[model samples]
Target chain A: MKYRGKVVVTLKSGVFDPQGVTIKNALHSLSFESVEEVKTGKFFEVLFDAENDAEAEKLLEAMCHQLLANPIIEDFDFSLEKVK
Target chain B: MKYRGKVVVTLKSGVFDPQGVTIKNALHSLSFESVEEVKTGKFFEVLFDAENDAEAEKLLEAMCHQLLANPIIEDFDFSLEKVK
Candidate 1:
């Protein structure tokens, strides 16, 4: 079976997020005064073969740990779905 | 009232995705043979004040168009939720 998966990798709380700060400043300069903060992260979608949804989930977790995210500085979460 | 929102900006289908290709190659080198393709995108989380969910959605759309995303090469989708 083929599975589609999405991984969202975000900076762990307390990590310095300069990119986010830059964007927030830009937003304010643009007059989005209501906006409080902006946090930026990485999103990845993958296509892979798996035995089932469970297998796909397992693979995605491995991918996150191994390559998709830097666990030392980031936290990751993901969702997997069977695809036609 | 405050709203929490998420924006996902992805390269449109058929657009060149070099980051994705480089990651896919890395995954293969790591021996994830079943993996077919990988796509990379940007994720953003925002906190902002709004009159209601409707207003939040409108603001998020504008943010994407004006600052958060480059519409010429990317497509964006977002969800907004009321935050207590």
Candidate 2:
């Protein structure tokens, strides 16, 4: 079975992101007067051939925890879907 | 009303992403023999004060279409929620 998974890795709350802050300031300047703050993260879609949903999920979790996400200060969330 | 919106911007199908490909190669080297391809994007959460959900969505769309997403080759989607 082929597995297509989408993972989002974001900084934990209270972790200051200079890049996010910069974008927030830019948003404010763009006339989004009401815009207050912003949190930014990376979104990735990984496609792999797995045995099944359970096997795919195990690989997906390992991938995120090992390489896709920085476990020190970031939190990762993902969803698994079977792709042809 | 205050609004919190999350936006995801991803490359259109058929678009080639070298970064994503590199990541895919890395995954392959990590013993993910079944790994095939990867597509990556950006995720952003924007906070704003708006009159209501309708107004907030309008602004959110504008942001995604105008600034948050690269209209040339990327697609954006967002969800809005009320915040204190």
Candidate 3:
């Protein structure tokens, strides 16, 4: 069996987001009423073939550790679905 | 006034996800049953001070176009809220 899944990886909370901050400043220029802090995260969609649900989870984890997630600062999350 | 917002950035659907594919393969190792396809998206939580909602939207658009999103291959989406 094959499974498709999504991975969400982001910098942990409390970490400063320069990209988010820049956007926040720009929001201010736009005249937004109440703006404070901005944070950003990543999203991914993957489609592939797998043997089973349990098997798929294992593969996703390895992928997260190896490439999807950065062990240093950023963390990652994902979801799986079977094509109907 | 202050506003906190979140930005979600991702590659358009159908975009090949080598990373995702690799992850799917890994998921297979994990033994996820009946797994088919995996897709990923972004989540962001932002806080900022703004004057009003309209002003905030404009700033957010600028931010999305300028830095948050890459017009070439990636697209981005965001949400805004005023802190109580």
Interface RMSD of the predictions, in order shown?
Answer: 0.5, 0.8, 4.4
For model 2, the stretches where C-alpha displacement exceeds 4 angstroms are none
Q: Per-residue lDDT of B1-84 in model 2, one digit per residue for the tens?
A: 888998999999888899899988888888987988989999999989888778888999988876889998999888898986
Candidates' RMSD to native: 0.7, 1.2, 5.0
Better of 1 and 2 by lDDT: 1
TM-score of each: 0.98, 0.95, 0.61
Candidate 3's residue-wise lDDT over A1-84, tens digit each?
Answer: 656666778898777778867766866776543555666677766666667898778777776787667878888877888766
Ranking by DockQ: 1, 2, 3
In the order shown, the candidates' DockQ scores are 0.92, 0.86, 0.45
Greater-lDDT candidate between 1 and 3: 1
Better of 1 and 3 by DockQ: 1
Best by DockQ: 1
Model 2: per-residue Cα lDDT over A1-84, one tens digit each: 888999989999989999888888888888887888889999999989888888999999999988899999999999999885
**Which residue pairs show backbone clashes in model 1?**
none
